[model samples]
Target: MVTLELKGLHRVRSKGRVYWYAWRGGPRVLGEPGTPEFVASYNQAIDSVTTPDNSRFRSLVALYKASPDYKKLAHSTRRNWGPWLDRIADHFGELRIAQFDRPERIRPIIRQWRAKYAEKPRTADYGMQVLSRVLSYAVDPLGKIASNPCEGIKQIYNHSDNDRSEIIWTDGDIAHLKKTCSVEIAHAIDLAAHTGLRAGDLLRLSWSHVGEDAIVIPTGKSGRRREAIIPLYQELRDVLARIPKRSPVILTHSKKGPWAPGSLTKAFDTAKEEAWSKGDNLHFHDLRGTAATKFYLAGLTAREIAEIMAWEENTVERIIRRYVGRGAAIKEKIRRLNEVRSRT
Candidate 1:
C-alpha cells in the first residue's frame, strides 16, 4: 500500500487497481512492500543482472504522473504538460538521476536542452518547467536525489507591452470571424466575449448553471478553487439566448456533441485563416480582457470584475488600462471628473 515510500518504486493504475514495480521497466514487484514476496522481488530486481541498465527518468516520470499532484492539475494544464512530459522522457531518458546531486554537472544538460528552443523562448521555458518539476519530485517523494538542478535556472521569456499578447478583438474583427466560423463557434466566441470564460469553461457551461440573474460556475483555469458569478447583464443574456439549449453542454461540435478542446481550437484556427488575409493575431483568450473593458465601461469596479471573472484585482486594473483605448480612457476620466465637479 505504501510501496511508494521506497526508492525507485513506480506505480501504475489500470482498471481501478494499482501495480508496483521496483523501477519502471526494471522488475515487477509482486505485492505490497514489507511482505516476504514483495521484499524478495524488490531485492532480486535491484540486484539482478537481467534487470536492464536504465535511466531513472522514465520511472521517475511514471511515479510523478501517478501522484495526486499531477492528477489535480487543471484539465488544460495537464493537456499542455502531457506532450512536454513525453518530450522530457525522450530527451533526458538516458541520464542517471544521481547526477542531479552535483548541480554543476546537471545544470549544463538542462541549459543545453533549453538552448534548442531559444528562438521560441516561451516554449523553451515551458519545457524547462515540466522537466524541473519531474526532477523536483524525484528529489523529495522519490528520495532519488538531493537537489533539483533546474533550481535557479532563469526563464528567457519576459512579458512586454509590444507583444502581440496585448492585442484584443475589435468589433470588426469579431464580425469577420463570426462570418467565417460555424454558427456554434461564432456563438462560442460571443459567449467568451461576454462572460470572459476560458474555452474549456465556455464549452462546459450549461443550462443548469444559468440562474435567474447570473451565470454561476467554477472556472477551469483555477480548477474549482474559485467560482465566478457573472451577472446576467442584458448583453451577456442576449448572447446566451442566441444559442439554443439542445445539449446539456453548451458549444457543441459539428452541429452535435460536446466541443472538445482540440476540435474547438481547430475550428477557431480555420475561421481565423478564412476571416483575414493578414489580420491581427489575437487569441480567443483576449476576449476575456475585452469583457473586462466592457464591465469597466458599464460602471463595474475592478474588484467586481475580478470577482466575476475569477481574476485578481490587479489583473483587472491592467486589463482596464490595456484594452480601453486612450481616447476612451481620457473621456471616461473627464466624465468622472465632471460628476465630482457637479457634486461639489
Candidate 2:
C-alpha cells in the first residue's frame, strides 16, 4: 500500500491520505491522497515530461546548454548535433517519451521518414545516434527502463569492398588542377594532399608552424603536436613558396584572421567543381584518404603512416586496409624493378 499528501493542493494548507499499494518513490506533496498505482502513473508522466517531447525539447536543450561539457565537444560535432535534434523533434511532433517505449510507434515514424526522404543508411545511422543521445539521460532510476528506448538498436550501414569511386587525384589530375585552379584553393589542396592535414587543421595553421623542411601541426585532431616533413615534390614546394607570408596564419585570406570553416569549405567546393567535370564528386576529406592510401601502397607501415599523418595507429591501419588494398601488386612491382636487367 502507498499514500501521498498534497501540500500545494487547492483549498488546503496541509493534508494527508493513505491507500493500498506497492513501492514508494517520487516528489512528496503533503496533504494529497495518491494510491500506489496512481503514484506510478504520475511518476511515469513526470518522467515523460523530463524527456524529449514537444514541450520538453526546450528543456532538453536547456539541459544541454547548462552542461559544462557542452563547450568540450568539437565545434563541428556540436553544429551537426544541433540541427539533428531539431529534425528529431520535428519528427516526433508532440509525442511524449513514455509513449515511445513501444517499437511499433517508433518504427512507423522511421519508415515514414525513410519513405519520404531517401536517406542513405549512413545518414539514417547518424539520425539514430542523435536520437539515442537525446534520451540517454531520461532512463528510470528504478531500473524498469534502465536505459533509453533507443539503446542497443543497431543501425544498418552500407559497406563496400569494391567501391573504386574514391577521388584519388592522379598525377595528371593534380597537374590539370594546378594549371586551372585559383592560387588560394590550389595552395589548400596542396597542403591537404601532401601534409595529410585536415581542412580544419590547414585553416588554423600559422606561419610559426611551417619550418624550413616540414609543416608542424601544433594541435591535431587528437590534440597532439606532430611535424610532417615536406616531401621532395616540386609542385607542393612551389604552392607554399608562392603564398605571400603576411599574417601569422599560413593560409589566410585576410590579416585579421584565418578563413572560417564554412568559408574554406565553400572555396574548396568551387575549386573542386572547376577541377572536375560532371560524374566526379569529391570532398576535401578525400584528400587525406588519398594520401594515406598512397603511403600504404608505397609500403609504409601503419606506425610510420600514423606518425606522418598524425592519426592513431589503429586509424592508419583501418584506413589502409579498408580504402587502399593489401599492396601486393605494388610490392611485386618493386621486387621486379630491383632485379638485374635481362641479357639479350
Candidate 3:
C-alpha cells in the first residue's frame, strides 16, 4: 500500500509495515487516503468522539469513563469490566435515568436485565456488578439520583459456599487424572494443587518466575497487589523437574505455548469429560483448597497459608477445619488410648 497526505491522517511504521490511523492516538483506518473507505473511517472516528448522549444514563456513563475513579482502575479490572460495560451501554444506553427514581422500580429492572445471563452465574454477576457501579457513580459524584438501587442486591454466584468435604484434589485424584488427561492438564493440576495459584496465573507462569529458592510471581487476582512466593517444596520441585523446558511457561497446550483463557477452559473441560462422566469430581479451583491442606499438614500456620494464597485468614481456617483433621482426629484418639493401656 502507498501512503498519501490527508489532514489528521497518521501514518505509523512498525516492524517494516505501514499502518494508517484516522488521527494521532486514534482508531486504525484501512484503505488508502482519498478513497471511500478511508473517508468513512475518518467520519466514524469523528462521530464516535462526538456522538450525542442518548440519555442521562449514557451521559453519566461517558462522564464516569472520563472520571479519575475510572482512570485509577487496574489494567486487569478495566479489561474485565470492558465487555460488561459495553453490554450495559448497548442495553440501557437509551433508558432515561430519571424514569426509575425509586428502588422498587430500578431493582426489578436490574434483575430482569441480569436474569438473561443466569446460565453463566459468574458472568451474570459481573455484569450486574459493573452496571451497579455505574449507577452508584450516578448517585454519588454525579448526584443524578437520590440513592443507588444496585446496593443490597444479592449476587447470584456463590462459589465460596461450596461444600468443602469433596473439594480437595488428593494424591489419588491427581494420579487418576494424570492417567487420562493430556500432559498439560496434568501439569496444570499439579501446579494448582501445589502452589494454590489461580488458572490464569499458573498458565502465565514461566521458568523465569522460579527464583533461587521459590517460585516468585505476582498473582493475577488481588489486582496483582499480592505476590505469591511458593517455596520449592520437594514435591513441587519434583513436578517441575518432570516437564521439559519446551517454552518459558511451565504448562503449555498442543502448540507448546501459553494457553489462552478460552482454550484453557476448553482443554480442562475436555479432560474432565474424559475422566468424570460417571463419578465424583474436581474443578481446577478446588486445587487451591488442596494446596491449603498440604500447607497445613506440612506445618504452616493458617495466617501463613492465608498470606501465601491471598486468602483471608478466617477463610483459610475454615478450609483447614473442614478438610484437614477428621481422620487425624480419630487416629489421635486411638493413639491416646494405646498410650494409657501401655502405661497401666
Candidate 4:
C-alpha cells in the first residue's frame, strides 16, 4: 500500500481493495484499481474548474519542482520565453499537467490560438511551440503522464520572402554617434560593435570578465564557458579608459545599477533626433551582427567566427545571413552579374 500527501492540498492512500482520497476543498472516494468507476471518479475530481486538489497530479508537479535543473531552466527559459509564457498562462487559467496530457485537449487549444492569431499567424504558431514544451515536462520519469500529446502537431511559421536588413553603422555614423552620445554610452556602443556581445551579456559585462587581452564569459547563452581574445587596439582601449570607477555599470547612467533595458535605443533615438536622420530600424542586437559581418569580411571562416561569438558554426552562418549577408552572398550576386555580362 502506497500513500501520497501534498502539503496543504490533499492526501491519498492505497489500501488492499481500493484507493482512499481526502482533500481540503470537498471530495472523498474509494474504488478498486483498474475499474471504470475508479478511473472516472479520479478524472472527474482532477478536472475541477475551481480549487482542484487532485493528489495524483500534484505528485508529478512536485517532482518537476524539486529537480536540480529547474532553477537553471527557469532562468534561461524566462530570459527567452517569459513574454509568451505569460500570455499562454493567462488564456489557460493555470492548467495542470494531467489536464494537458491528452492530444484531444491540446489540439483544440492550439486551434483556438491559431484562430486568435489569424492576423499574425507566425506569433500564434510560436505560442503553440512554447505550450508544447511546457507540457512535455510531464513525460519525465516521475511525472504522471506517460507521453507528450503535443508531439505530432505541425507548426506553421509566417516568414517574408525578402530578408530583413540589418543596421550597419558606417564610419560616418559611428563618428557622429560617438561624438553625440555621452562618453559612457559611446564606449558601450564601441564595445558592442567590437565584441558582438548580446545586449544582455554586455549589461552583465564587468572588469572581472576582462583579462589580459581577452574577455572570458564563463556562462554564454549556449551553456558553455567561452573566452574570446579581444585585440587591445588603441581605439578600443581609449573607449574603455573613460569609465567612472564610481559606477558599477560599464555604461553609466544617473540611476544606480546597470544600463536599463532599451538604454541603447534611447541613446540612438537622441542621436537620430540630433542628426536629423531617421534612425536605423536595427536593434542593439544589430551591433553583434555588424561585428560578425566585419569578421567575415576580414576572411575569417565561420568556425573562427563561432569561436569568437561563442556560437555553433551553423549559428554563425545564420547570423551572417540574417544580419550581415556580406560574404558569400555578395560573391554570389557578383558572380550572377558576371554571368549576365558573358551572356550579353
Candidate 5:
C-alpha cells in the first residue's frame, strides 16, 4: 500500500474497494492512489481549498478589485467606486461570505447605510448598487456565496421625489451665467449647452479631438471603445476660435494647465450663486439637459441627439419629454397650420 499524506485527502474502504475522499465534509471521491487521475484530482482539491481568512467579505472585495471586469471600468467610474467600496469593507470586512447567504442579514445593514445619507438618496442608492454587484460576483465565478442577498430588496431612493424641476436653465439664465463667470467658465457653459457633453468629457477634451467640422470622442462613460461624433455648431466654433489653445486640453484654468473636476465644480457653483442669487437650484449638469431641449426644438430626432450625446434613445426621449413638454409640440403644429393657411 502507498502511504499518501495530503491535507484534505482521506482514504476510505467501501464495497471491498479503496477510495480517496477529497474533503471530509463533502467527501468528493478522488481516484485510486498512485494513479494519474488521483494525482490530478488531489492537485485540483488543494488548489480549491479556501483558507479561513480568505472567506471574508474583505477578501472577496479584494478579489473583485483585481478582476478584469472591475479594471475595465471607466476612470471616472473606478474613482467613484473607491470610496463606496472602502465604506462597504469598513462595515462588513470581518463577516464571512457565507453569512450573507440570507437576505435578512444584509437588509438592515443596507437600510442603515441608506438612512445615513437620506438627503442624498441617489448617492445612498449607488452604494447599495455597488454592494449588490460585489455580492453578485461572489455568487458567480468565486462561488463564495450561494445567492445574492440584494436580489429582491426594493431600492429606497425615489427618482421622482428627488427630481428637481429647477434644474432646467433658460436663455436668460445662460446669459447671466456668461456674464458672471470668467471667459473659460463661460466657454465651458456654452460648450455644454451646445454639445450636450458631460463635465468629465469636457474636461478631458483635447485639441487633438477637434476636426474641421466635428469633435470626435474616442471614449466616454460607456465601457465600449466606440467613438462619438458631435458636430461643431457655428456658435461653439466661434467660442473655440476666440480662445487660444495654450495646452493640449481645450478647457483650462488661467494658471493651471487643465481644470481639475473638483475645481471646475467649485468655480461653476460660485458663478451660479452670483448669477442667480434668489431661488437658484441650477447645476452645471443642467446645461446638458438644456442642450437636449434645444436639439428637440431644432427638429433633430431623438436618435440623432442620442448619437451626439452618447446617450440611449430612450434617455434622450425622456429628457425631451421632461423639459420640452407637449406644449412645445402643440405650438409648433399651430404655427405650421397658420403658415399653410397663408400659403393657400
Candidate 6:
C-alpha cells in the first residue's frame, strides 16, 4: 500500500477493491496502491484541491492583471487604469464576488459615485467603465461571480443633445496665449497646434524623433508599430530652433527635467487665466482639433491628415466636419457666387 499525505483523500472499499476519492471535488478512482495509475490519480487529486483562491474582488483583480489581455494593453492605458482599479479595490475589495451578482446592487454604487463626482461626470463614467471591466473579467474566466453587476448602467456624461465641452482654439486665442504665457508654455502650445499630438505623446517626444524636415513617432496611442510622420511647418521650425536642446526630450521645464502631467495642466490653467479675461473653456487637447482644422483648411486630404495625426481617416473626417466644415463650405460658396456675379 502506498501512503499518501494529501488532504481530503479518502478511501472506500467497494466490491472488495480499494477506491480513492478527493473530498468536495468528488472521486478519483485508482485501482490499487503502489501502482503507476494510483500515483497519477493521487497527484491529480492534489492538483484539484490546490487551485488558487480567487473568491474575492481583490484577488480577481490580481489575476486579471496577470492575464494576457491586461498585459497587452498600452503602457499609457495601464498607467491610467491603475488609479481607477485602486479606487474600485479600495471601495469593494473585501466584498465577496457573489455580493455583486445583481445589477440592483451595482446601480446604487454607481449613483453614489456619480453624485460624489457630479462636477466631473466624465471622470465618474470612466471609473465606472473600469469597474465594469473588472467585474466582467471576474464573471467570465474567473467564474467567481455569476453575472456582471455593471450591465445596463447609464453613463452620467452622456450629453448627446448638448454641445461638446471641448472647444477649438482660434487664431486670436493662439496669439493671446503666445503673448501672455512663458516661452516654454507658448512653445508647447504652438507645438500642439502644429503637430496635433496628445499631451502624453508630446511629453514623451525625444530629440531623436525630430529630423530636418519631419518628426517621426515610432509608437503612438494605439500601442502598435505604426510610424507617424509630420512635416516640419515653418512656424513650428522657428519655435523649435529657438529652444536649446537641454535634455533628450524636446520640451522640458527650466528646473524640472520633464513636465509632469499635473504640473503641465496647472501651468496651462494659470496661463489661460492670464491670457483670456473671459476664461475660454479650452483644454490643451483642444489644440489638436485646432491643428486638424488648420490642416483641412490647408487643403490636406483626410487620409493625409490621418497619417500625420496618427488617427483613422474616418476620425480625421469627423473632426474636420465638427470643427471647420460648415464655415469653410459657406466661405467657399460665397466666394464662388461673387466670382460668378463679377463674370456676368
Residues 143-234 of candidate 4 have per-residue lDDT tens digits of 66667766777656635543455556655667777776666666677888877787667776787676677676644464444545455556
Ranking by lDDT: 1, 3, 5, 6, 4, 2
lDDT of 6 by residue, 1-344 (tens): 56776666777779997667765447674756667787788777676545534566676777777887777677879999988888777777777666787668766866786577778888888888888888888878877778887787778886765554336888888897888798788778888888888887888788899998899885557775566789888877886887778888888886748888667768888999888888877889788878877777676777898888877666766766665536664665586688899999
TM-score to true structure, per model? 0.69, 0.60, 0.65, 0.63, 0.70, 0.64
Clash pairs detected, candidate 3: none
lDDT of 1 by residue, 1-344 (tens): 34345678887899998788888887789966678888788878877753434455666777778888788788778989999998887887767767777899889988999999999998999999998898888888778888888999988998673454346677888998877678988888899889888777887888899999999999888877788899999988888888887899877877578987667877887788888767557877788767766776677777898899888666777756776555556766787899999999
RMSD of 6: 7.7
**Which predicted model would earn the best lDDT?**
1
Give lDDT for model 1: 0.80
Number of the top candidate by TM-score? 5
* 2 or 4, greater by TM-score: 4
Worst 10 residues of 3 by lDDT: 323-332
By summed lDDT, the worst window of 10 consecutive residues in model 6 runs over 158-167
Per-residue lDDT over 146-245 for candidate 3, one digit per residue giving the tens place of the 0 to 100 score? 8888888898988677655546777898898788898888888888888988887888899999987888887767656678888898999998997779
- Cα-lDDT of candidate 2: 0.61
How much lDDT does each candidate structure score?
Answer: 0.80, 0.61, 0.79, 0.63, 0.78, 0.76
Model 1 misplacement above 4 A: 1-43, 46-63, 86-106, 134-152, 158-162, 178-182, 253-257, 312-342
Model 3 stretches astray by more than 4 angstroms: 1-55, 66-80, 94-105, 115-124, 139-147, 156-166, 253-257, 277-280, 312-344
Task: Sort the predicted structures by TM-score, highest score first.
Answer: 5, 1, 3, 6, 4, 2
How much lDDT does candidate 3 score? 0.79
- How much is the lDDT of residue 298 in candidate 1? 76
Off by over 4 Å in 5: 1-55, 94-96, 104-123, 139-147, 223-226, 313-344
lDDT score of residue 243 within candidate 1 = 85
